[model samples]
Target chain A: MAILITPETKIIVQGITGDFGGRHAKLSLDYGTQVVAGVTPGKGGQFFEYGAHKVPIYNSVADAAKATGATVSVIFVPPPFAADAILECVDAGLDLAVAITEGIPIKDMIRVKRAMTGAKTRLVGPNCPGIVTPGTGKDSFGGCRIGIAPGYIHKKGHVGVVSRSGTLTYEAVFQLTSKNIGQTTCVGIGGDPVNGTNHLDVIKLFNADPETHGIILIGEIGGNAEVEAARWIKANCKKPVAGFIAGATAPAGRRMGHAGAIVGGAEDTAAAKIAVFKECGIEVAATPSDMADALLRAAKAKGVTLT
Target chain B: MNIHEYQAKALFEKFGVAVPKGTTATNPEAFVTALAALPEGPTMVKSQIHAGGRGKGTFTNGFKGGVKFCKTKADALAMAGNMLGQTLVTAQTGPVGRKVQTIYFTVASDIKKEYYLAILLDRATSRPVIVASTEGGMDIETVAHDTPEKLFKVLIDPAYGIADFQIRDLITKLGLAGAEAKNAAKLIRNLYTMFWETDAAMVEVNPLITTPTGEVLALDAKVSFDSNALYRHPEIVALRDLNEEDPKEIEASKYSLSYIALDGNIACLVNGAGLAMSTMDIIQHFGGTPANFLDVGGGASKDQVIAAFKIILGDPNVKGILVNIFGGIMDCNVIATGIVEAVKEVGLKLPLVVRLEGNNVVAGKATLAASGLALVAGDTMADAAQKIVKLVA
Candidate 1:
């Protein structure tokens, strides 16, 4: 009942020949994901060899998808080519494309996003830690581990975690795992101002998933995405949700690492987002360390068992 | 990256977007020559800095304004002299202010009316939007708050570009007519071209003026390009003024580290941007102020750790350091070893708290224990932030 992917989801890795792509592709394989094929444009007919897993490589996404029957792709292409890689996934009609690459130009992403309108391929991130639907195996091994997120911290269960920050997502997941709480899925929509997915998009998916009993929504300063998501959750989502927004102490106009993490105006500040979350009946995590406990409180108030 | 007003004006001209003819001088001696490039009539003397609210800014030397209107070239030159080297404190620029290293002189246009125009991505629609208003030459935020109806927006479909109907709607909203309307339409088209071609994050013309002669001009230009797209725009990169940035931040960029200097005293070095920001928040939560936000990125090397330490230590306000790492793809042991080496190399006296989690954390903790450095260890981010705050307290 994971939202986007599962242990049985067949996946392809774009930019599989590069150092970063190859390394993560191997890690994804080690996590027991069904890494069916690889796409490197010019590296066709080759195979990425890691331990016993030898994933075949094709020159194009279409070729890879056609031969291997892979439905999803995780892109690790460099920024300059990342946009084209995303478009190729749309062209090949992949169910989803998880872009792990960062630093893609905003213009490129704006075009990529525009082109993806009404398309079948749902793009995840251009500057994000990807998605994970935790496996039932030990340490959440054998799950659909897509991007650069560490595969070991996850546990298979009902709580859905969605965030824009990589380590913050891990922080929440780790907190949940430590308390013996498992998650149905975890999605990082990314920190880029022009990303494929937003907080609202992932929240809707989580709310729709019957298996996801509770949700953790992590956001930061900048953009009205978090506010939009919070308002939506209040009106429609009946599931328990905990929220955490970073950059509370951040100064105005200073970009805090993430391209989209800057405080643009009064509406998008951490304070404003936190207020909206609280107003929406969300149990707000006072600190990053309290994310798991906050969710527990929300679940208890709703009389739902997350574990 | 934000370019100076003069640079933005030059870029505007390149894209067929009209602006007041301007010249810049870095020294007072060249102010006269720079002023000569403009007409004999009224001129605008502006301090070239990255921040806004320059028109109302006061200089440290007791000079009245960063921007001034003068009737003669000699008067413009005098105003330029007052601004060229003095620090101008504005609402946007913190109390410390920024040194005015360059002076911009432009021929003042006789405004028939002032309008506001900007091209930026609309996050809601995921498209380029033109925010236009009849109210201009003032804080747009204020206008948005007080007179919301005066402001209008036209979302440009990336697929079809700006439509003629949208332009007409915008022109009507702005109360433009005849040649002014035609000129404004052209300017909007050209501005969109520049925004798309240059990969600009935002193109803001605070007062898009229609002169008495019916010529539409961008009276003030504030353009920022996407740093991610800077590789394709070497021309824009060349316009980068290093003087406007913190030296420590510039140094951090050289090592691919993301660092921003803050006003607090507790310096934080962490892995991942989100975690780094959270570390700062956690520090603040514990009643300790964070001096800086430094993300060493994933897979930080030994050299990067040393560089980060140097940058954090360079800030005189820093009383203690907190190193938080949640190694995902990153190996915790590698980071721990790097931290140990960084401390040994930098010769730290400030109290330091290190928290390592995730991959190879056991080995990482063991490495730190064996190093025997005078560093406190925390089991989690909360523990680490509290430890640093308490130690510094």
Candidate 2:
């Protein structure tokens, strides 16, 4: 019942010959993710061997898909070429592409996003921590984690987590796991000016998943996506959602860490978002440390037990 | 990255967008050279800073506004002198406004109507959008607040480009006729080109003016390019005004470290942008002010870590420093060594707290413990936050 990825999700790693890519490819294979192929131009037929698990290399995504039948893609290409990597995955008609690479020019994403409208592939992040869905019981089903998230932090459970921040997502999962509230899936939509997925898109998926009993939405200043998500949470999602917005004390115009995290105006501030969440029947966590507890209360309201 | 008005005007010209001829002046003393580029009659002595609301802003030397219209060269030069080096205080720029190092001396156009027009990324539609309003002089935020109906938005389909029908609809809505309608349409199209081509996050013309002869000109413009996309456009990068930014921010970019100077006491060093922000928010919540926001990033090297501490210690206001790392793709032992090496190199004068979690936590903790440095170790984010706050408080 996990959202996005699962035990059978065949994976392909883009920019596989690079240092980060090669290392993470090993890690993902070790974690039991179904990594079938690797892609790096001019380095085709190169074998990526780590312990007993060995994957074939292809020069192009189309070749990887044609031979290995890899349905999912995780891109680790550098910033300058990340956009083309994403478009390449889309051209190959991957079911989903998780872009682990950060700093892809927003204009490049501006084109990538428009290109994805009618395409078969659904892009995750150009600058994000990818998606993770822990396998239930002893890591049997390949425990679908696509990106560089610490594998130990996630635990298989009913709560689904979606966020724009990377380490903050880990922080929330840590809190949830500590409280014995495991996550069904966690997705980092990203922190760029232009991103692929949003709170509503993830929430819609989580709501339909029977295993996902609750959801945690982590937000920050600079955009009105949280507000729109709050309204959607009220109207559509029957499952209880707990939310946290960072940069409460952040000064206006200063970009606090993330690219999309600047207070635009009155409507885009943290307080305004908190108010909207509260108004939408969402139990809002005042701080990052309070998110897990707030989610517990929300789940309790919905009669779902954790711990 | 926000470019100055003159820089934006140059970009506008490059995209075939029409604007009033303007010349750039570095200092107020260079008014004679600036005025020489302008036609006779009336000219605007506009202060060049990163912020908006400059037309309504006041200078520290008791100058009325950042912008001034003058009929004579001496009057324009005098107005420019009062603002060139003085700090401006705008509604957007708090009490201490940015210093006006550059002045744009441009010929003023005869305004038949003032309109507000901008092309920006619409997050809802995931497309480039043009937001146009007949009400120009007022801030667009104000227009969105007071009369949202007066504002018109057209989502430009990336596949289709800007359509003639969309332009005609916008022109008809603006009550434009004859050559003015055609001119508005052309400017709208050019703005779209500039927005997508330059990878601009925002292309704002606050008061797009129409002359008596039915010509549309961008009277004022403020352009912000996507920081992520700056690599593709080196010319835009060259236009960056380093004097306008914090020296530490510029230095942080060199090491690929994401650091922002804040007015607080607890200097934070953490891994990941999300965790870094949460650290700041938690620090503030515990009644402790954060001195700065510094993220060494996901895959930080030992040298990058050392450089990060140097940048943090560069700020003398920092009373305490907190090192929080939730290692995922990053190894904890590497972070631990980075901390030890950074402290030894920089000579830690501030009370420091270190919190390391995930991937080789025990080895990381052992490394920090054996270092014999005066560092407060925390087992959790909550623990680290409380300890840093207590030390600073």
Candidate 3:
């Protein structure tokens, strides 16, 4: 079983009328996800036509959820309005909201995060690749595909993968799939400094899931989220976890691509985080290419069968 | 998004955070007029550059310091002459120093005591935090490491804002009483306002000093704004000093490409930030040095690829190129087509290794193969990185 999503998780698209949102909405439908509804404010009575699928549109998240029984939403709204779209999902009391939009202002996110104090809806990424629970069909086709992750690389199985990078997550998933290993779910928590979910939050879910036998945790430099997660894993988790931290060659204070991937202090550097991972009994990947193999080694050491 | 010291001080003044009376001049000829505003007592002349450690920094012309204190305004003027138009290299500026286009002149205050204060987002708490210390005018990192107790942090609740009690606690921590305490409280409030209202990434006041007359002032200001929020603050965007940025980086920004120059020989062009960074790591793992970090971003157009190629080739250190794309929403065929066009337009000479995966990857590989552009294709990221390293070697 997947940690967050499954084939039965019906979902809606927030900006389903825009080019990016519309394109991904069609792709998600094509992947056999339960894409039930669309939300585009003024485009209320319209429908998004994708092959045989014709999803109804609503003016608000609440309306879409009520009419279509959609529990999840994938936001593709622009940066200026992305925060509000997230808030709408929270207000609608949807089960989860996955924001695929990037470049949202930090201040907007700060307020959104504050407003989500005890909300029912779980927010995923504002600058993330979203979540993919691999299907049982050929090329992982029948499972839930939220946001923009390439669905074909996933294989339904026991190992859970979580990361702050999109392509990096794909890299790990591809490696695992190539080795005939499968995953329960692959989550990209995003690379923004103030994203909704983090490495620790996703790890807790993976730890609780009985089907997730082993996990691959990918992180980069910047905040202490990875270290925090590693410490938690050391204290409580018995599952074999393989970790990889990027930005070993990144200079101090210079942001390397990701807004959150800057070397702020000594604790958040690649070396410091890797040291923490080692001390926490995590099998750290020497390079990004070794993520899958590192997990395999960890599982073997723990005698945890991952296949 | 970092602003110069003078620009930060001006911003501080606008936010009611008092600073030393100062004036700036961009040339030696304007030094007389700029220093005329000061009362001719002990004055400080400082080079205007984005990086810190200016006081202890040395100029390329063998000048001793980027910042100097003079007994008279004439001495200040002379020091400004030595700094203006000269390149000042600091610990943070790397080997190639920034040219000091402007010099700041201020009336050096009689210091009664020094304290440190800053306002920035605490990533763990996800709130604004005020870091204060009695031990000022020194490296905060050193203070945090050696004497952790000396540092005082007030995590402000963004919902309720900074409370009066937190400010009072800070004032007591700094051992301030009466007039100085009152001044520090107001300064802290105003600083928070500036930080929130301006959407600042960080606002630091090193050596937040109290004068002999019990007046509190910001002696040094280091402020950076969030680039994503820059659209709302045109005034802050106006303060952007393009001279302080690499020309290639600035050009990359124009085309929505994320590029950071490095000191290696193999340049990498990839899609997505996380993949770009790991691409660098994989290259290094294979005993190769990456010359630059370039993320053409998701959904890169054909023009962006050409623009990215031009920017990468601009660096003379680059000997070969690696293009790694694990496309999700970003189609790999588009990237492959762009690479072909970029190579043809730029008249390629260097060995290029391309690795394409996910979302029409087969078509992407076919596009590269059909181009007849003399490029090598790898099956995976590791294979591609290894191939480029060997070719470049």
Interface RMSD (Å), each candidate?
A: 3.3, 3.6, 3.2
**Inter-residue clash pairs, candidate 3:** none
* TM-score, candidate 3, chain B alone: 0.99
| lDDT per residue (tens digit) for residues B61-149 in model 3 | 99889989899998898778889899999998999989999999999999998888888877887887888889999888888778878
lDDT of 2 at B18: 94
For model 1, which pairs clash? none
Q: Note the Cα lDDT for every prediction shown.
A: 0.90, 0.85, 0.91
Instruction: Give TM-scores of chain A for all candidates.
Output: 0.97, 0.94, 0.97
Query: Which regions of candidate 2 fall more than 4 Å away from where they truly are?
Result: A136-141, A256-267, B27-29
* TM-scores of the models, in the order given: 0.98, 0.95, 0.98
Span of 10 residues, lowest total lDDT, candidate 1 chain A: A256-265
